[model samples]
Target: MKRSDESTYSWLHRLNPDPYSLAVNAALLELVPPGLRLLHYTRTTVPAEHLGAFAFYHRKIGPFHLDGIPEPMQREMMFVIWRIIELGGRVPCAPMGLLMRELAETTQRLKTAGLPFQSLTDRTPAQWKAELSRTWVKRTHAFPNPQTFRTYVSPLDRACKILWFTYDTSPWWQREVWDLTMDPRIPRRTQEPSGQKAIHWHTMEPAWLRHGGMYFVKSMMESSQLAWSTAHGAKNALVQFARFAMARGLTSPRLVQDDRQLRGLMMEFLTELRSTPNYGIRNRDKPRSPASIGQITSTVRAFYAFMHDYGDEAAAALDDDRWDGLSPEYLRFWRPGDIGSSKKEHFDESYLYSDADLAKIKAAAPLLGLPRAEGGFGDPQAMRILLLMMTTGRRINEICMLDARPLTLLEDNLAKLRYQQTKIHDAPDTIFVDQEVIELIQEQQAWLHAHLATIGADADPPYLFVSRHNNLRGQNPYLTHVFRTQLTKLVDRAHLTDAAGDPLDLGKTHRFRHTKATSLFNAGVPLHVVQRYMGHTTPEMTMHYAQTLDSTAKTEFLKYKKITSTATESAVDAEDLYDLMLLDTRTDRVLPNGWCTLPPAKTCEKGNACLTCDLFATDERFLDIHKSELVSLDSLIDQRQEIHRERTGEPMSENHVWLTLRRREQQALSTIVKNLETGGSKPAAALPAPATQAREQAGMLGGQGVRTGHRP
Candidate 1:
């Protein structure tokens, strides 16, 4: 082959003539640009500096000593070098370096054993390692260290598997293995916890059923009907169904064509799922939980529903007519009662970290990123990510995927942080953060800049917490599992425990979000405000995280005593009233400045007239609020009177219906404020006569007299 003039290997007028060298040159010509190859080199020597300039250079591997090695070994080395270059196209740089080193070592070992180099297809990793070890001992009269030998062989084995395996990029519906990571339509957030990315339809028993399932999953993805995580879960549940189908000899979709048989099959599957040992690694020997079984049954039902709805399209996609057997009745394979309810009777607060535990976690958080030599976890980025989570209450992925410059200072000098709302599409992506959070983020930015500089990476990184290894451009964010692993180490090192005194499961990094939400809500933050701050699409989602703190609840409830419109304390016992009204659980009874005093069973006849109503009550806790409202009301009344008088060309009537109601409300507020100012006293002048009190009670109860019993 003619070499280009700019090619680094152009100086080689005559090649080694060996097939390996010729093959290496040919492969390099295609794989690498001509300008990148060694242009000036002597036959006897290949310089290390020249090799260092190549894209596939291994930092640890030095110059080739061609004169010292035999011809055969040199040819073998060249062949392996070409293979390394090919593998590097698929793997990242850091891992590629290790793989190259291992392959180079293996080449040397093979040269020593006087054995021809063989591909993984001809010899398995174990077989090659065993042969190498036996040959080394026979020739040297000693054994190689077991650990060192395993290390030498491990990377080669991994590299071989990667090189030999071809990733399927065909139309998703046509492939048995759906590699979600390669699918651009799928968001990275939905492919979480790292490492597990592919959905293996081939693992499901019965080929025909597998194709039908694949069609369902593909349609779901194409239409954005399900997230990658949810789709993966559905795939898992279908695998369970496939297993049951195989066991019952229902190998084809046609086997259960009848709706009755399908229903029976589902019932049998549910029974088997309830009784069978879990196939999952975590709880392998235990029976699945009701929630787990329910999820499986629901997924299977959904799969059937999809098949029934898209029977024609699925049949065409799979090129199989069997999918036509699916009927609308198959959609109702399981009834609502058959599905187990997974709702908890009470919310579990065990996930929320206590103030004391939080302080402990904060104190020990630095150890997460400390060097291993310093008895730390040696993952500083994880420590920063943890601190960000603690302060900003961001989801782990949001923090991980933060831009290098995420903070923008507002007019008030406070900073607003911008993060990707990965879970909720098009949700609010920016949140107001305090100075502490701003400083933490800035510190992280500075650390990342310095780290990239040290590693000779891209100066302007895309992510705040860039992946530490295998990412030369600083393009990808740190993996969520990496941060969790470091956090788990910190928990163990600090002896962190949950409320139950069990070792804390920092694996649920989301507990930080729950802790922050509950703290803010308990500190009197409004539900709508908290929802916006947490980037929740609905107040319901915010409430899920904001469990009421018992201490806060008690403190707030006992902060005031209920006083009536006459400024006298209510006759009902406070504790009895609290229970009778179900104030703790009833949201409607809650008001801005106070709570409604109406009996739980009664309906108020007058609306927005709480101030003059006998059943309306408040206390000193709302003194300032009432004062503000009274001033505003007085101003409003004055403005309205002026407007009416100007329009009618005379003073507005004091007996005007609106004026009368306003004056009554003003009198009631004035009495309440004066009483509260005097520490819950009844003003002698404000106290009403027995007939007036009876009339007020009659008006409040819609003409019904006060009952002769304990007030609710």
Candidate 2:
């Protein structure tokens, strides 16, 4: 065997005496085709590509001798094998032996059976052509993609030519010489003109081109110096418009000069856009969403308006007033609901992560950065970015674009991150992150520093988020999409769900921002405060992120009405409130001195002395509370009576006011206790208690005819 002590062969030579390496190398040499034998290199350093030669031979080309195969078949097969091996292969030699044996057997059978299309020596021209047609049909049916059937036909014909040469008495037939120099999948040519080509503007009639329509677009591009992407979009839209016009035999700009025709054309284009699928190269059936349709309409409208000013000397023809229905204002039908209406219905509530979902994500967060050997994808940067987005509610691009300098180690275990806001708003530049996020950042910094050293000086970047491998190493990687993909994996692993019982979706990373904002609002943070926290310029924009759930509303409204007569006030316990709202579901409740005016867990906007307002329903349940309050009020009334007795002539109006108010409260408590002791009358409907009404009317009339006596 040929061998050398080169570095490439060192590993092989070290194991030379080993049976497995010797067996593998022997099998590879026998399995590789004769013409392809030059591909194997055992003496010098083999390029990374030669490692995959086994798979290339087995998958793309058979291991048959070059002389055994016809000339045409040999050329095409050799080209495909060379191309695949050049890219690199990963098949082991042992499995390659089995695969190559199978391929060799198959090729032998094909060679034995003559060509699928019989030669002219054994059949007439028509008969031979018919056989060739059937063979083409069979091969086309066997191919995966029907669109590429024509592309594969030539190579298959070349393979069949081998059988023809082996059996037929006639000479090789002349055929079209198709190049097998490059893989068909690699785009070798493009029909699009070099640089940014203008639509067929020059082909229009001289009169129409002279009308300034074409010149208008050219001037706009030159004057505004439109961005490359923007100019590209405008050109594409105009080209599509030209195609539409040409199909209808309205090639000249003059054909659409009439207002009615122009308006009709716009309507037809929009309707077509609404129905058309978003035709990608691979995915041809995905329909354009409402937003996409809206964008097309807006672009078309802008193009017309641009031409109206610069192209048409008579600007009034394409003015907003002239083309009433085709204006951008009419394109607003795409988004549902009016601007001021509640945006709650627009999004799927299940998309937002809940507290339980958050817990699951936290548990799964560590697994994101674990090594692949430990069942992880080994991307700690993705984990750190996702955690930052979830906790900070910052935009994906904003977080990805941050530099190491942006992270500040603040006092009191807090960390502040500062980045310039790109949304062009009045929000602050800083965000306060917690200790957990800080720890993640510090860990990433250490890993990055170490990795940079190992990768060499070229792999060190000032940006915090850098790609770890390939051409992207040491660059601002813009890992927002990577963060999203890893986040989805974590979500699936955690099995998170929404309130609606649907599995949560992590596709829209913005949901994390909205989730954080909504949580802050539900925590009773003021709207303006939440706006600042989320770095939103306006309260309206911040409100868009907050959700109004029934549970949150019930909890906050209950706090507003938790009043007491004592100096210290108390609110219902959360468990009690939940039980009252869900488990019990009863409408009746007894207050300290009167009935509760509110429904079970429902809010009362007017929160004051419960005895005064209507809707109070009391029974034996409140007996002890009412009796205790009655005794206290009675003692206070007697003191007021003593003070009134010392006043000259008549008691002061203020003293009468005090006596009347105390007496009313005392009566309410006594009635409640009496009803309880006697096993109660039928429970009262939610109406005003008697004494509360009398005291309120007297006080309203400047305490006129107020009673100073303690009748109760």
lDDT of each residue in 1-712, candidate 1, tens digit only: 1112112111111111112333442343354334323322222233332232234343443222223333433333343334433222222233334334444555567767787763332344455567657756766688977775654444445433322222222464565545443344443453242333566665577877788877787777667666666778878888888888888888667556556677777778888998898988778879888777888887777787887777787888788877775766777877788757865443455557877779888998888878999998888888888888999888998898788888899856498899977677667889998888887887888898888776555688667887765455455678887888877777788899865688888888888988898888756688898998899888877767554454334434555688887787887666655555446445455544555677767777766677777776666656666776677677778888898989999987899998898788788878988888878544332312212333233233211211111222
* Candidate 2 residue-wise lDDT, 1-712, digit = tens: 0111122122222222121222222333343455555423222323343432442343423223333333333343344444334322122333333323333343454456763411112332233334444444555554234443332232233222322222222211111111112112211111111112223333333323222333444444445434322444554455545555656667444346554455566667666665666644444678766655555555555655555444434334323233223333333332343112322354644455767777767677778888989988788888787788788888776677666556787786797888646453346878777787788778877877776666442344656766553312354344455677777887677666655566667777788887888778756578888888788787777766554443344433333223222211224443354345334344233233333434555766534444433444343433454555566556655656666678665554644765656655566556556645664343342222213434333222112222211111
Question: How far is 287's C-alpha from truth in model 2 (Å)?
Answer: 6.2
For model 2, where is the 10-residue window of minimal lDDT?
171-180
Cα displacement (angstroms), candidate 2, residue 241, comes to 5.5
Question: Scored by CA lDDT, what does every candidate get?
Answer: 0.63, 0.47
* Index of the highest-TM-score prediction: 1
Cα deviation of 553 in candidate 2 (Å)?
Answer: 3.3
User: Which 10 successive residues of model 1 have the least lDDT summed?
Assistant: 8-17
49 in model 2: Cα distance from truth in Å?
23
